[model samples]
Target: MKNLFTAIFILLLIVSCLSQSTIQYIYNPPENIKDGLDVGTLAEVNIDSSLIIKAVNKIYGGRYKEVHSMLIFKDNKLVFEEYFSGHKYKWDGDNHYGELVTWDRNMPHHIMSATKSISSACIGIAIEKGFIESVHQSIFDYLPEYQHLNSDGKDKITIEHLLTMTSGLEWDEWGAPLSSSNNDLVGLWVHCEDPINCILERPLLDDPGTSYTYSGGNMVVLGEIIRTATKMKIDEFSKKYLFEPLGVDSSTWAQKFDNGVIYAGGGLIITPRDMVKFGVTFLNNGDWNGKQIISEQWVEKCTTEYRNNKGINIPGQASGRHGYSYSWWLKSYPKSGKKIDMFNAGGWGGQEIMIIPELNTVVVFTGGNYLSDVRVFNILEEYILPAIN
Candidate 1:
């Protein structure tokens, strides 16, 4: 009995050590980039390095059971970049029962709601190129079928309202059948033959711009609006204006249904490295490698909190320690009783692109937490943030 106990204890120790090593492996900066540029030389930001390491360790030890990647950049140089799991690109097509998946630098994973941020960027580009008239323009102007609806108050809805998630259109963001009636806009993407028509048909639950409701329906509507205004498919416009410029050419955009439109709210697949590039672009204020991809004005407007959802001053809200800006989330914390501005692009599961503009820093994290786990955020706040310090 004593020998058996000793063997079991040794086994547990080995498992624990292996787990710790895995965490370190994922957080390690990419070797090629590290050799080319020193992360320490990137910029001057006061971060506790030990805290950052602890944060990374905690996240990896948590319940997220999929590939994870992160990158931190300050100034114009790469500070940190790394990947975990031999499974870099874990898609529906790649995962089969008991198959040993090997993922590396080039593997692409589904980004989920992070796509909303990218879609928002596309809209900003359209606005800068004169395709979109203004944020105040009536949405019906782009989708004329919406004009037939007896939506008197709805007509007052503007592009800004939708971008800020204050459109007041009824929507249940949480995918609960019991909660479906809270927002009549549920299943618009999956059920409707015409997404634009489905969105226009939703009944107004409150006056436009009066409340805050997180709506995937709103994002689908924005995608339709971009398609109409630009007279191009969402995927094409994204490629020409956003992806190609960033040198990210391998990502795939999945549609909700066969012969249907791309799922603009969440269904984008991209590499972890490419995801970092997207965050870095925002950190650089919409420029990439010396070229202006998105207008500086658009970046400012989209990142700043545009409306007060209910009583919540979005940027001042405590939920996720962030505020809603267009499709981005503005994360801030009170330092000495004053709110400091930080922002992030987040997705369902554990995908995040956190930016601290004051520090000229950007961090990206991706994982598959889904509904089975909620510890990923805890890891971010308690472990990841401390490690960067």
Candidate 2:
């Protein structure tokens, strides 16, 4: 018995040591910009080295293991970048099983629903270029073909309602598990013939702009509106205005078409570095370096709390308290007893693009923990935020 106990103890020790080593792995970013944004060390950006190491250790040890990559930008330079290897196909109920996936600085990582935020940016650009009239314009105005579907308060829906997620469409993406047959998003993807028409035909649960309903379908409608107004496919339009201007050519969007109309609700895949570039552009108030890709007013309108949705709780969030603003999720992080306002472009399977305007920091995290509790935000609160001096 004694010998057996000793053997067991030794095995545990070995496992613990191996885990520690993995956690201790350091990510050294480039010393200078060769083709993209400038890079620097964590310490150079006022982040504590020991604290960040400890944070990475927790991430490597905990359920955060699915994290593919994490990037931090502060003081206008890339500070920290880390990537991991995990399963690429992590759907909870789907039969699609993929091989092992390893991410690096160059590879594009799936951002899932974070694409909604990107879609919002596309709308901002469309508005700037006068392709779309304004957020106040009725959505039916853009889709005259779908005007026949409009009735009984549906015509009251505006572009702003779609962006703020207050279209009051009867979407249950949050209320039901993604694996459930009743999940509205899954139902739309699997069964709906015309996603835009299906969403527009949804009976209004409440008047437009009266209540907040977390719906990806609203973005689908907005995407079509952008396409109609600009007369360009979303991929082509985004490439010419957004991606090409940012010098990002490696990104891909999973655009689907039904009867010649495009759906841009989600499935935007890009590198963690490129995601940070998008966040930094918002941090710079719609300016990409010198050019105003999106107007400053659009940036403010989207990030700010346009309407309060405190009662609607996100499924896996422990806090269960979040606000919505133009496809972005708004939350206040308690850093050293101070409430730091943070906005993020979040997605299914743990993808996040968080921006802290007060700290002038942008953080990008990609993972494969689909439909599971993502504790990445806690790591940010416990390690990243505290490390900032």
Candidate 3:
């Protein structure tokens, strides 16, 4: 009987050790402070590790099964980084198929429409450096190729309208499934020869800047403006000002180009770790270490909730109401009173770079569940935030 009790005690001890959680990090300390993220313990960062472990298990075991990677940073140090194997949709000759892929610490994942936020940042930098005058300046002034369309209500469109997605062009990207031919962005991509010309040629559905209308054409136009302003491609400009400054030069950043114009609406591929650096830079008010990669004023304007469109039911947005900023998505957590202020760069298939200034935390996600991207909010609320002390 005593030996039986001793065996049970040994089993319990093994279970206890197996259930214990620790922060598993992948970054190596570089000689340059700007080259890598600092690492810390969940306890030291004031986070509950056991709870975080449960969150990671939920991501991999069943819940959020489509998540490719999940990362969290607090106090400017990486606390949790986890990757999962999943399948990505790709074209195979005549049809699309799910290609099995393994996500790790170093692989670059597609960010989809999150590229819009990065493109907006480039425009802000261009404005600060005097490459572009201001967001209020007419977009037509820069694109003489579309000067013919400036006669009607299109004449009222400005750079701010494009950034805010209030340009009110006849767009139907959010109105239909991406696989459907009716989706405007997909149509523009597949059928149009020049996406910029395709967007500019469309008649205005509403007066510019009066109401909200999510348009990829707005982003395509911005990409051209950046090229004209900086006299360089989007990739080149980002390398010089954004990626290199943050020590993300090793990353594989893929940008789409049609007829020499980068597809600014989407098609940016970056690693989950580098995405966290971006969130941290914005959390630190656009400063990376000691260098100002993006101006503080631009960060504030982009993150600020410029328009509150709550209670409006938008298709695919499970959360009924959300505010819009320059190119960032804004929504409060808990969906109730005394909410936690949060802003994110969200993309199709659940790519996110979430920033919560109140908690000094940045959460990054790369997912492949295109139909249910909003489900990540549940993971954030039920698991991630609860893991915080």
Candidate 4:
């Protein structure tokens, strides 16, 4: 009987040691004064550090390859930040390629279609500054140069329609891979002589705001409108109104093949740390550090749309079809058998900024999963969300 008691004591001691080992480790990201983001330990935000460590281990363990960076902001403080070495997306005329590179806090990563969200913010800023009147204004009001193409209800397209991607332009971007010349988005920047004219000349498939479609052409048109109304280039406008105010570390926007026109649809290249700030701004109802970046009205409108009307199927968006917002993808994450309200600005090759208003959290990721399956959503659903305390 004494020997049995001794064996039981030994088992208890082993289990206690295992439990202690699991909870003993914690990760605290370093603070950078220049970054302008307040830093705090994950414990302060009631996040499970062990889960984050497990997620990082899976990343470094090669379970989720081609991931470059990950960051988490909870309660307006950056609680976790991490970077990894992965492939970066590079492009030729129509072909997309990749190169293995080391990622860091300062490397500016191309955000692809995520630039549309920033462009949406630009539109809100333009309205706040009285560049144009409102989103109800016709696109032709700013693009009178393309007034010739206004026949057959094309002239009826409004800025709001463009923001919601209901412009009704017959654009074929998702029909083929971007590397194929058949993709209209690739042709607009590469083969077409004039992007604005090329997109504007497309036939109107439906009356504006009647159907849902995902096209980068809508964002390009909005960029032109911003330029026309603000009397400045998209890059300059963003720096002055968006990036500068948000304190972005560094950024670059790619231009047209042979012109100065910026591809506001997918041109932004910024560090992952800087990229998440935009989501934070939206989470705070268009306010950043006590300054009203965009009005609260825009924020509410940006997230109001919750219908996945057309059964949009996007790679890396395997949480089923997501609803469209003003350049934002409205989604709900399933947690504890209930869906949590969430939204994101996702781009090709795994660049993403996901915000959960219910949790008051923002998650950022940058990767090079071009033309391939991505592990981003899996990481979020499995590791990140479960880490919340």
**TM-score winner:** 2
How many residue pairs clash in model 1?
14
lDDT of 4 by residue, 146-181 (tens): 888878988789999998888888988778887877
Q: What tens digits encode model 1's per-residue C-alpha lDDT throughout 210-287? A: 778877778877887898899887888999999888888777887564446667888688877778788878888898
Error of 3 at 116 (Å): 1.0
Better of 2 and 3 by TM-score: 2
Model 2: residues with Cα > 4 Å off, grouped in runs: 1-23, 31-33, 90-97, 255-261
Q: Whole-model Cα lDDT per candidate?
A: 0.68, 0.82, 0.79, 0.84
Q: Of 1 and 3, which scores higher on lDDT?
A: 3
TM-scores for all candidates: the values are: 0.81, 0.92, 0.87, 0.90
Question: What tens digits encode model 3's per-residue C-alpha lDDT throughout 1-389?
Answer: 99999999999998876665333333322222334788776777877777777777676555675888888889878877778888765534122327778888778888888888888888988988899999998999789777877767787899999999889788878778877768988887578888887888887888888888788889989988988888887888888888888888644435454676777878788888889998999999999888888999999998786654233344554554667788988877753346788888888778889999988999999888766535777778887787777
- Candidate number with greatest lDDT: 4
User: Using alpha carbons, what is the TM-score of model 4?
Assistant: 0.90
Could you arrange the candidates by TM-score from highest to lowest? Answer: 2, 4, 3, 1
Q: Considering only N, C-alpha and C atoms within 3 Å, which residue pairs clash in candidate 3?
A: none
For each candidate, C-alpha RMSD in Å? Answer: 4.7, 2.6, 6.2, 7.4
lDDT, candidate 2, 1-389, per-residue tens: 99999999999999998877655656576555565688888878888878877877666676575777778899988888887786675455343235686777777877888998899999999988989888998998999789788889788899999999899888888777766658887777677888887888888899889888788788888888887898887888999999999988877876575565555777787888889889999999998888888889988987788666655466765545778888888888877678888889998777899999999999989887775677788778878899898
Give the better candidate number (3 or 4) by lDDT: 4
